[model samples]
Target chain A: MIRFEEVNFAYGARSVLRSVSLSVGFHERVAVLGGSGEGKTTILKLILGLIRPDTGSIIIDGDDITRRSESELRETRMKFSIVFQEGALFDSLDVKENVAFCLREYTDMSEDEINARVRHILASVGVEQALELMPEELSGGMHRRVSIARSLALDTPRMFLYDEPTTGLDPVNADNICGLIAELSKNGKGFIMVTHKVSDALKVADRFIFLRNGSLLFDGNRHELLNSDHPDIMIFINEVCIQGPSGA
Target chain B: MDVKRTISDLQDFYSLSLHGLLGIAGRPFYFKDALLQMDYAGAGSVVIVVIVDLFVGMALSLQLAAELSSLGLKMYIGMIVGISVVRELGPVVTALVFTGRVGAGMASELGSMALGHQVDTIRVFGLDPVKKLVTPRIVSSLIMLPALTVIGVAVSLLGGYYIAVFVSHQSGTVYWTSIRNILTVENVLAGASKPFIFAYLISSICCYMGLSTRGGSVGLRQATTRAVVMSIVMIIVADFVLTRMLLYVLGFSV
Candidate 1:
């Protein structure tokens, strides 16, 4: 489980997250929805220990991680994998090498075993043919898929973090990615996906979290989220309703 | 520049350099990466170092020989050119050139990685970016810069030989003998030591700049420029301090 207690964060003088408190279960599928600069992504970065909270405690599996050193944070980070907004694939590495990187570094798997695992992971993400292709050759959707494959390469992570995974894709591709995320969320694998798109979030997440102006506006199931008369939630839902599901 | 910010940055740069130095003896050594970087920092630099030093040597010989011949000391051309190149010019020039090429490349590459979140990704994978990226670079620069300086000195002497024997009409044997005689232990040691320090400063500063990059392309440009400019300035400054310190250590007067 991951929990953030009264977490606050700022970049220089500009506050990005303010006194936010939340908890996520080991098998929960959650989507954190917010518009641009609403601190949705900051939550993911904080949880990953890439950045620390200005105040408050972030506990992973009951261990407070706010004061952990970087080398120490590596242990906490190993429990989760993240897909960055821009894919963030190593440009110099081919798809196969990118997926195999963690395994090669952390595991003592033989070459054949590593190759087989890489192929299986890539195939699971529907990009098996891209094994030899560099990141520059991939489309935005394919790049995200490859990034997902790389993240999934390590089997030990209990949760996954997705940052605006479908923000830039075309409507059809976005739908396909949403479908992929939903499919991957099965078998008790939990994920916290942060995005600005309500439609995409609804497809993959059973629980919805609304962040607005650097604070938690709402956190509940789909039914509570849909029925809530909260002005910001209503505005987000109304925008999605008027613009249709893609919200593109 | 804000004084506090500058001081903070220096502190961070020193910390990073120390971390990279310690990583050299740590486990999971990236020998292949270091070898590749050596190829990039060393072998790739040969032609440029040779070309630039060759011209510098030729010009120094032409001017020094002309002045010396007027006083019947033209035969000492090799001693002057050799000692100057070996003791001062070669290492400083090579380090400045290296800062422009290798240091700038390191900053841009790592800056792009930071912007792309690749560094964070490495951290997420339980790997240290300083160990994986900075250590190999520091090792390569530490080894390659000195080797390149030696090459620089050799070509410079060759260029001086061309000017002294061909243009100035000095005896080739006398010029060679003079060069051979003047390269004392202290002179060679002083010249050879500067590149190692310059290499460490260049690699560490550039890596730090690259990893600290923020914003976007504009930030990358700023970091790259800072890496090159700061490296060059530091190299020049270090050269002066090192020369003086080495002379003192070697029991030289003044």
Candidate 2:
């Protein structure tokens, strides 16, 4: 459903994405793994058209988003939802308004209907009774769940994007989020999660692409990744699971 | 800062302002946000406005009454205070106060929002940050700055009236007539005109500073500080230039 064809992007004189290419099928749960500052999040930003590729194309379900205008990009952007690393809820708004934001901006839904939708999404995310709570009033875990609810608020989202969704999360919360990702995949929704958290990826992702120095270094399933002889991959996997069979 | 970089920054600042103004004209008008900001920027400012403006008026009268009494020109105290407040003090003080209060407020609010990735959230949801964020502030500043200036002028005149009656022992009717005769539509136009421009400068500069903020919480603090200092300086500077222009255009002596 999404494809990156030899995409290259730069920040000033420094290249951030270099000849990078990848794809995620409509039902695929793909995790892009990288150490910090390896340009993992930039891939999500580019795919969203927040920052365009300098060269090559990002085809979102067949549309070449690289050449799209701001108005065109807005139309394309609604097809995908992103959960930012920090949750990114509107601070001025409470949980209800934050969740209902897109609908209020884009839809003609009545106030009661919007409130109902927001209530439903928040409940689904296990955050009931905090509908009137402001973003600052919520805990970190609640913020993440609220972010998820906000993203899923969009109708017919073709693909979801997560930027380090598990960063700073406790193990139990991380597992719950992984379960949510699994559930979304079960519902036949594709998603790309960028993270350094290998356990989260192992729990939820169907495939992994390891990033190193602005390029894709390893792309494979969990079994293939664990069995690989790549030194860096072995070291990373060891960090996640100290009792790995391929332990160094 | 490099001269070229400064020029580019100015260009970006104006671009952001124009985009925000355009957002006000476009669809999906954020009437709720505009009203909320009006409450914040307008209604929320009453206490500070009252406290600061009342003192300013009282101080101007006291200082003028002291000086004019020695020359036996104490009867003209109301005239001096009236002209000064109407022509300069009222609007300038309002802008300066707004810079400290509303300008800093907008900067910190938007700065933290940027830091928390809320601005990008608007973009991710396919909403323009200009529409969602900047326009409401601009609208409120436009409505409120002028509103505050008028209040300041009225309170200052009342203070002058108090000083004239009690301190100078001038006739109430003469004191009232002195100020009333000097008050012209042209003078009102010249003074009243400034807050409109001042409002835009305060709102736009703070919005730009707030949105362009980087680093982290420290960046938000710095942006808010810069927004206030720059807004106050611009308000004062713009006041001078605008005063000159308005005087010439309205046939008032500069």
Candidate 3:
């Protein structure tokens, strides 16, 4: 459903992504794992057409978006929804308004219909009581769930991108987010989660792609990731993943 | 070069202003958003304009009366107060006050949103942030600045009236008569025109400063300050240009 062909991107003299390439198919939830500043989030940005690659093409839903203008790329982006690293809820709006944002903008659904779906999605995320609360009033976990609900409010989201959704949270909240990802996975929808959480990734990811220093280090299923002979990959999967920082 | 930077800034502001206005006329507009913003920026700022203009009028009358009394022209103080407030002080002061209040608010609110990635979320959802954020502000500023200016001019004239009649011992009827005679269609047109442009200048600059914010908290702070400072500078320069143009266009002496 999404493909990055030899993508290269940089900020001034500092390179962020280098000749990296990967593809995600339908029914596959790929987790891109790396430590901080390893271009994990950049992949989401490239796919969203928020930033263009220095070289290579980002194809989403069979359309190349590397050079698409901002206005033109918006149509291509309608097929995808993203949850930013910080949940990115609009502070001026309540949870109800935040979740109903895209629906009100893009859908012709009546206010009551929109409210019904918003209530249902908020319930699914376990935050229906938070519907009237402002973004600042919600807990970290509730904010993350509301952000997800906002993304899900869109009509057809072929791909969902989550950037460190569980980055700043207790284990309980992290598990709640993992459960949400797991639930989304069961629907056979494609997802690309950029996180440093190894245990979280293992909990919800069907395939893992590890990015290191702007390059792809490993790409395989869970069985292959655990059984691989690569020393650092093994150390990471066994030791670091178990004991390393969950949100670095 | 400072000259080069000024030219570039003006060019960029012009382009953004065009885009902001286009969004007001384009499809998918949030009319409710624009109305709410007008209430937020316009109606919200009117009281301040009136309060400030009233005191300014009193002070202006006092100073002008002192100067005129020395020359035995104390009776003409109303002409100076009325013309100055209408032709210059009213619009400019209202804009500066609004810049500090409403303009700074636009910058900080939008700046915080940019830092929080809400702007990016709007983009990812295939919505234009310019339309969602900038247009409403521009629309409100466009509306409030002029209305506030008219109210401000009236309040200042009333303030001037108190000072001229009681403080300076001038006849109230004579003072109002001079003001009524000098306040022509041309004078009203000239006084009323600048606020519209200043409103656009302040809102657009602040919005641009906000949308281009970088870093995090520190950047938001800088964007807010820059929005006010840059807008003041922009408003002053625009006032000078517009004043000169309107003076000539309305057939008044520059």
Name the best candidate (by TM-score).
1
What value does DockQ give for candidate 1? 0.84
Worst 10 residues of 1 chain A by lDDT: A239-248
Per residue, candidate 2 scores C-alpha lDDT tens digits across A1-248 of: 77999999898788888899988786788999988888899999988898889999999878998988777888778878999998988887899888888888778999989988998988888897889999889877888899999998877678899999888888778778777877777777888999997777887887999988899899999888878788877778876676332211
Q: Which runs of model 1 end up more than 4 angstroms from their true locations?
A: A243-248, B1-4
Query: By DockQ thresholds, what CAPRI class is model 1?
Result: high
The window of 10 residues in a row where model 2 chain A has the poorest summed lDDT is: A239-248
lDDT of 2: 0.86
Highest-scoring model, lDDT:
1
DockQ for the candidates, in order? 0.84, 0.75, 0.84
Q: For each candidate, give its TM-score against the true structure.
A: 0.97, 0.94, 0.95
lDDT of 3 by residue, B1-254 (tens): 58987898778768777899889888987888989889988788878988999999999998998889999998898889989999899988989999999999999998888888889899988988888899989988898889999999999999999999889899999889989987999888889889989998899989988887889889999999999999999888988898889888888763
Candidate 2 wrongly placed segments (more than 4 Å): A10-15, A54-57, A243-248
Error in Å for residue A142 of model 1: 0.7
TM-score of 3: 0.95
Candidate 3 has a DockQ of 0.84
iRMSD (1 decimal) for each model = 0.6, 1.0, 0.7
